[model samples]
Target: MLLGSDVRRMLPPPAMGRFGDLLAATTSDTSGLADDMSGDRDANAKLIEAFRQGVEQPI
Candidate 1:
């Protein structure tokens, strides 16, 4: 996600290492890092509420 903003949230952590050894062979950056991830509670809540509203729009 660019600048901690994404259309979707991150996937499950344990579900990432599908390739096992193959994945370990490569240097990856998407390690669910705290610094890269957003910790802004207010902004996150707003985004979540917006998503909920968008979903409810069709209903």
Candidate 2:
């Protein structure tokens, strides 16, 4: 996720008008998603799902 964010940040200036609008929309969507979350519930759910999937195997 951090890598994805970094790549988005590194994208060069938008070329066409539509491309600029797309970039703006994507940024707004990301900001909205982050702001829509309330507390640790979202974080906890993510962690739980990760563990359930065995992606982050128990230590």
Candidate 3:
């Protein structure tokens, strides 16, 4: 979901760099862990709407 990308994007530069290093050491493809949010817009929109609905509901 967009939350994962959003959280990664929020990471400090130093931490993000470290994460990239770790990914490089363990995985052949680290593109998914990149600090980019250029993911599926439609999926992100649906997630946002679901989140909003959850927030508006009572506990």
TM-score of each candidate structure, all chains considered together: 0.34, 0.27, 0.36
Better model by TM-score: candidate 1 vs candidate 3: 3
Error of 1 at 42 (Å): 0.2
> Model 1: per-residue lDDT, tens digit, 1-59?
23122212242334433433333332233332323438875565555445434422322
lDDT of 3 by residue, 1-59 (tens): 35445545666778866865554453333443322346785564555445434433333
Question: Ranking by lDDT, best first?
Answer: 3, 2, 1
Query: For this target, which candidate reaches the highest lDDT against the unseen true structure?
Result: 3
Lowest summed lDDT window (length 10), candidate 3: 27-36
Query: Residue by residue across 1-59, what tens digits does model 2's lDDT show?
Result: 44333443455545333544554454453445434557675684454344333321222
| Candidate 1 error regions (>4 Å) | 1-37
In candidate 2, which residue pairs get closer than 3 Å at backbone N, Cα or C atoms, i.e. clash? Answer: none
Scanning candidate 1 in windows of ten residues, the lowest lDDT window is 1-10
Please, what is the whole-model Cα lDDT of each candidate in the order they appear?
0.37, 0.43, 0.49
Which scores higher on TM-score, 1 or 2?
Answer: 1
Off by over 4 Å in 3: 1-4, 29-59
